[model samples]
Target: MNEDRRGLLAATAAAALAAVAGPAKAQESETPAGPPPGTPEGNPGDFDFLTGEWRIHHRWRSGPQSAEWLEFDGEATVVGILGGICSVEELRIPARNLFGMGLRLLDQERNVWQDHWVNKNSGVVAAPGEYGGFTNGVGTWSSIYDQDGVTMISQGIWDEITPTSTRWRQRISADNGATWQETWIMHWRRA
Candidate 1:
């Protein structure tokens, strides 16, 4: 096998260990007190499952407040870095002439993940990225954003995970978490 195969196998093994060990070992030195109820403590290799090429089915609105939905197909390749403590996903949509990168870093000290998006056109890391971790097999990372001068809560959810496929949804709400409108949704399958 080549180096890529070796690295992926290593990442997969590390992820298995983390899942079996739970968060106790990872959080032992970081904080004696666990995260507030319902929050999952992040661990290294949490994103190892994403370390591979993926075919993405994308759906999104034209604008944050737009009701019209557009669909496209894209491709993505995710790689594990920093010993699985970090992962980078490169996304490409040739039809739309759009490309972007997603960086997910594990905050070992805080036991959470910080997710940032970098647009190819801007070449800047978007400020105030979402922060959250997996709980009961579902991962939710969220942050606050200002949309048209109104404060909105934005969430990126990873669910319906399987060995070969997963679903990601992005939703926003101006009224706290009382209501949400899905802005983008993507179905990812191993490519």
Candidate 2:
């Protein structure tokens, strides 16, 4: 009777172990091997130039404000946040008391850059616009606004860049690009 009791206890323990382990083993087998979330799988090289910090020197003038110009120091940071689908850039200008955020995304099908921008003061965002791809290390976008009794059209271009710095220009045309009134030109040094 003692030997039978011992044998029964061993069998019960083995059965419990199998019952617990069976589901876990099956789950592991069913899981598919795939790339991790937010991993950049395609065309990651297109936006690689925008992944740094920069100190910007901005200059601008409009209409009769040409002689009495506005100057300010600003900064820009572009990072691959949020699933690597796009890059977000934050720009800060202390002299003009302005700050802005911009989003840049590359459309694989269209082979163009989709650019969006917003200003802190106005709280208005520019509409979706297409950029003529980055070639010779340059890209630009422009928008027109008629808010607060001011008809202002603005254009921004990333003209040049190195490992540690970038040069950008923000030009505003009150009378359209036909007679462009250069509003802000800035150079950014890496910080």
Which candidate leads in lDDT? 1
Which pairs clash (backbone N, Cα, C closer than 3 Å) in model 1?
Answer: none
lDDT values, one for every candidate: 0.77, 0.58
lDDT digits (tens) for residues 37-127 of candidate 1? 3456778988988888899999989997788999999988787878878777778999799998777778788888777677789766553
Candidate 2 overall Cα lDDT vs. reference? 0.58
lDDT for 128 in candidate 2 is: 46
Q: Give the TM-score of each candidate.
A: 0.77, 0.58
| Model 2 C-alpha lDDT per residue in residues 15-116, reported as the tens digit of each score | 432432357767477433322222232343555666666677877664435566666677766665434446666677776677876766555564455565
Model 2: pairs clashing at backbone N, Cα or C within 3 Å: 60-183
